[model samples]
Target: MANSANALPETGFLRLPQIVGNPHANPPIPAIVPVCRSAWWLGVREGRYPKPVKLGPRTTAWRIEDIRALIASL
Candidate 1:
């Protein structure tokens, strides 16, 4: 909850806020990767981050496994 996505389950997908966080929300979700949204997307576009899964026309998410692997690599 502090600096990493270890709080996540062993298998699943995570939305953008659940990954980069939403500090202004009711409960103030902590960041898993600790990067701004734009930077995150840039990383994605540049192939420095994991590809996302489109769950809906407007919903994009990344696999928990991919995030875990990204954290490990970092």
Candidate 2:
């Protein structure tokens, strides 16, 4: 009998390794870097991506999964 490991589906998004290399992930940062600001905003306006989360006093970030889905759909 032969054993094989099934390929896992992309479950979460992550930050591009260029900036951070495999740090502990909660919401999967993103394998690729973030998209442009205007583009992201447009995506939100189009209801393609979910609203961003408040990270700091004023900073915000979109759900990585949402971003990935948006790109895929586009």
For residues 28-51, write the lDDT of model 1, one tens digit per residue: 988888899999999999999999
Q: What is the C-alpha lDDT of each candidate?
A: 0.89, 0.45
Q: Which ten residues in a row have the lowest lDDT in candidate 1?
A: 1-10
User: Model 2, 1-74: lDDT tens per residue?
Assistant: 00101121344333233112234566543323245546656866897657666767856655555545544554
Q: Candidate 2: worst 10 consecutive residues by lDDT?
A: 1-10
In model 1, the Cα lDDT at residue 58 comes to 97
Which pairs in model 1 have colliding backbones? Answer: none
Question: Between which residue pairs do clashes occur in model 2?
Answer: 14-29, 14-30, 14-31, 15-29, 15-30
Task: Give the number of the best model, judged by lDDT.
Answer: 1
